[model samples]
Target: MADPKGFMTTPREEWPRRPVEERVRDWDEVYVPGALLPIISKQADRCMDCGVPFCHDACPLGNLIPEWNDLVSREDWRAASDRLHATNNFPEFTGRLCPAPCEAGCVLAINQPAVTIKNVECAIADRAWAEGFASPRPPERLSGRTVAVIGSGPTGLAAAQQLTRAGHTVAVYERDDRLGGLMRYGIPEFKMEKRHLERRLGQMRAEGTKFRTSVAVGRDLRAAELRARYDAVVIATGATAWRELSVPGRELDGIHQAMEYLPLSNRVCEGDLAESPMSAAGKHVVIVGGGDTGADCLGTALRERAASVTQLDIYAQPGAERDEDIEPWPTYPKIYRLSAAHEEARDLETAPSADADARLFAASTLRFTGDGSGHVRSLHLVEVDQARLPVPGTGRTLPADLVLLALGFSGPDREDGLIDQLGVATEPRGTISRDAGFATNVPGVFAAGDAARGQSLIVWAIAEGRAVAAAVDHYLTGSSRLPCPISPHDRPMTV
Candidate 1:
């Protein structure tokens, strides 16, 4: 509403990324700082403030997108931050990491480029921090109820913050030495700096949310014992078990899982190590799998100055444009995307002989070949059909010194004694089984996030946390006032 003809007058312009050559040399964020501020307000003004905002429905958090967009456009950053924080607990995290399905569902996106909702949201949150508008709000009265929240990921952190503000004594337990779960370790620092997480943790601490790191539940104490110690227990331990490749030569010395390689790089950034144990320097690197994780590996390997880099995907390359019938507007599209990492890879592929990258679509890995030193030397590959099945006549070999398996995660770590002690039912797919209310078969216990829902986005994790907190509060007090953002059975608009 800031400008009635804003959508017509201005076209969408995205935030600028740092130049490929300059950014890949270090672990800095890909986006150029201060580059989006000039155009962000204008881009935000594109929101029509429609009568029925489908973008709300598209978001798992049900973020007040239009309201905040208008507020940002008008330069009312305080009000915009309030509106953005009303639903989402971590705008900075989602702004940096989320794929922004809300933009896909923008009404204008049916024809024109969608409003810059994500950029506006990040700007509002950042301005709030700078202006001191964001502060902890502790409850005036204590309810004297104590709760134990297992996990320190987005879901557990959101639930812990909400419950603590609701006058409950909440403690968040993390198995890792530091808080932020995968956000702290699994995610590369180039995608999002760890200081953002530290600042939020500071605010949560000020709000009276207690944190217990390096003390895993069901190991330090039994699940039943934990329930006895607290009035209620909320499980948000995320899926940690990586989906593995069972092809031949899986035990080669230079072969590693994406999780193994990613965490080591993150540790190096943390100054915990001088270098990554799985460094790709001077090695011919081949990454299998073409998901976001694979792209992440590609970027990291290129930064390490690999001799050469090649990425293989079993599926055919996705179309550049969205498929209208199968994926309509107001829902996340199935179009191909060029992530920052992919952009760098493409640049490298077209660069001079000194800087060359390679990508192979519809390629399947058959096995690995190792040298006498027990280190990976090459990969056995085959050209895959449209169905992703290997074709016998199209086999070939590619020289490789380091092979990274970038397949996604499977489920929560069952080895963590928690699952064994609780005896919670699990789906055939390995995810924890929960009812519509996010309640497990056991009474007075509830589950949320990747632990229950499988691998998903931070936005979905926060939504599940909000929903699970409401159900737990209702069970505890016979009524609840917390907003249940999403149901356990509700899949994302993208799904």
Candidate 2:
């Protein structure tokens, strides 16, 4: 256990971020350099070492949270890292990206701020890389079986790493020029730099994980051909079918999906262009969503020096803190937690009185108005009640040169013909259907991650990937030792 009275003595402290004004000028991450190391031990020591750690139940990975906290408190960086990597295949990704459901379930959160589980997890993994403890672990002997993993996202990469270490020859195929599906293009560099991804890819290659880029499985090579060449196949194509707004003016030339606009900025960071073709520069941008993607667009638009940026949300703003009456203990609460992007945006907003936040809330977009030439010029919206009915005399208009829809994804893009070729069934909710063993109806074929479970957090994707690999190993060998922690349909107890 960590320090006995650590929770009482030490307060919850997060790693400080770079000043918003300074960070906006560059595409680098928002955190201050070397900020967490000095205080990490004290933060880790805040773990209560509860008799019943609900954090394990909260995390799909079943991460050894308290064990690692103790290890970190003791300054055993290598041991802490080993404990962290035992379940999660990609702590670095989750650390930087995940909402940290484990912290939400922390025993400390019942009465106090939760322990810094995500920060400690990230620190352990980063330390491992710095100390050369994260060297490649190639298999001793080949199992002679081969596996083809479609999609180079977290799930596919995790499964490939596990299967390769378990002695199977593994090959990952990506449709884009580079590996990392959403992580590569969808995520901005200000959140997680590509160097973190590049180093991990280098390690995977050294461990004998063959990568084939710019190859679309169903389009270029037939599904039958992929299955024929491999002993098994794992599909992690991910749900990228972006949801659309069917309101009037949907076809405005300046309006685009979040995926379309987000990736263009990512390409600019890759030196593809000095300026993104879809840039919000000199424009009045209006984002019509309230999720992480919307926040990302807000930050990016501000960096591009948009004349003004406004975000629209249909729901009213949440409370400053969780209300037990609505969302009880151990549950993920709906609270107003300011994200790094939101923090930066609040500093620049120049509104006086805000009925529903100076930006927007409880507002429904009526339609967009474009110029005669077809470029968007303005947006129309109305105030909405609790039931989303438009209120009277609440209509307003805002200038909009470029608009983005971050309304979230619907399902996997099946237009490429991969699902039809494999003959796998899809659920009514639009995700791929899989058995308890993570296998589809077709033998030797399996699915995991967002493709199977719908769009979710990075930790869940890695856990799904690890669990699916175990199932594949068992299917091939009849008996296997790989750990299968959760099945496809297991939803978290907490919201």
Give candidate 2's TM-score. Answer: 0.98
Candidate 2 wrong stretches, greater than 4 Å = 350-358
Please give, for residues 1-495, the per-residue lDDT of candidate 1 as tens digits. 899999999988998999999999999889999887788899988999999998999899999998999998899988988999999889999998888989898899888888988888888888889999889888898888888999999999999988888888999999988899989888888899999999999999999999999988888777888888888889999999888889899899998888889888888888999998799998988989888788888888888888778888787776877788778777788666888877887887722221124567778899998989999999998888887788879887888899998888888887768987987888888888899988888787889999999999888999988888888888777888999999988886753
Candidate 2 lDDT over residue span 258-351, tens digit each:
9999998999999988899989988888889988888888888888888778888888888878899878778788787788777777786722
Model 1, residue pairs in steric clash: none
Cα lDDT computed for each candidate against the true fold: 0.87, 0.89
Candidate No. with top lDDT: 2
TM-score of each: 0.96, 0.98
